[model samples]
Target: MGVDNYKLAMWTFLGSECFFFGSLIGTYMSYRGKSLTGPYPLDVFDPAVTSISTFDLLASSLFMVLAVHYAKAGEINKMLGWVAATMVGGLIFLGFQYYEFSHFVHEGLTLKSNLFGATFYVLTGFHGTHVAVGVLLLGSLAWSAKRGHLANIGETTEVIGLYWHFVDVVWIVIFTLVYLLEYT
Candidate 1:
């Protein structure tokens, strides 16, 4: 059988996303430690709080897996439940990010404050935008499943799953490079 168009499209999109994120990360790495100001990464980063957000994002991947499994099994209600759970996880992670950004601003970090602020916000902000989009997609899937409008639930869920997993993996890299590695 030929590869499904949707699956192929999603893979192509993700390939482009890899390059997009790679450039952001590369820029961040090149600018690391060049900030000659207050609220540098070491002065403002709180890895412990970010760790919770990371865990929430990782847990959403589990929910995505369950969503796909139930969709394949033709269990609409279970699929909806899992999809909603995943969306909730994404929302919670975004909340944590919002709080962190607010705290940083209060601590004197802004996009114009220093190179660290600019690159850090740009990288993580874009990642957060991706997560928000994923949440919206999952929300739409849940709504469609509820209305019995999903024609190919299994294939659709799997496509969404690929995107969700990609976001999670990107966060793992970001968390390691931006948060964890700052200490070392």
Candidate 2:
């Protein structure tokens, strides 16, 4: 009765997400280094800048954890504050991604350019979409919190936190396999 069904549903959704992202990652790996053109991985990937974005996302995860913690403690204002912070972090991450994508397109790496371009865009683009959706969800949660309409703050925060963490984790894997591995 106490969010047991909600928790189960979230877990089921996350289980499917695992497969969804797994296939994308797998496709990216398979197509890595197959792009027979310029603006390739080395020519485009700026790890230093991307590292900053990655750190921001990781920090957002921390904020989400704190938000859930405060929600569980019934501290509505603090939870909302942390949720706002998390949304800002997500926006920053998306900004970085947008800049990167624009730069890539400017540098002549379109989705149809080659295998690398297609796979890279498809994979990271999907991830970016997920982040955008998370931002919207968090924004909605914030609005609900402000309106005093959220009945189960803890459960709500926990469910959204689960999704936020999944997005972060997927980026970690993508950063490692798609970017770091390229350098090595």
lDDT scores for all predictions?
0.93, 0.93
Error of 2 at 32 (Å): 1.0
lDDT of 1 by residue, 73-113 (tens): 99888988899999999999999999999999999999999
Lowest summed lDDT over 10 consecutive residues: which window, candidate 1?
139-148
> For all the candidates, what are their Cα RMSDs to the real structure?
0.9, 1.3
TM-score of each: 0.98, 0.97
Top-TM-score candidate index: 1
Q: How does model 1 fare in lDDT?
A: 0.93
Misplaced by over 4 Å in model 2 are 1-3
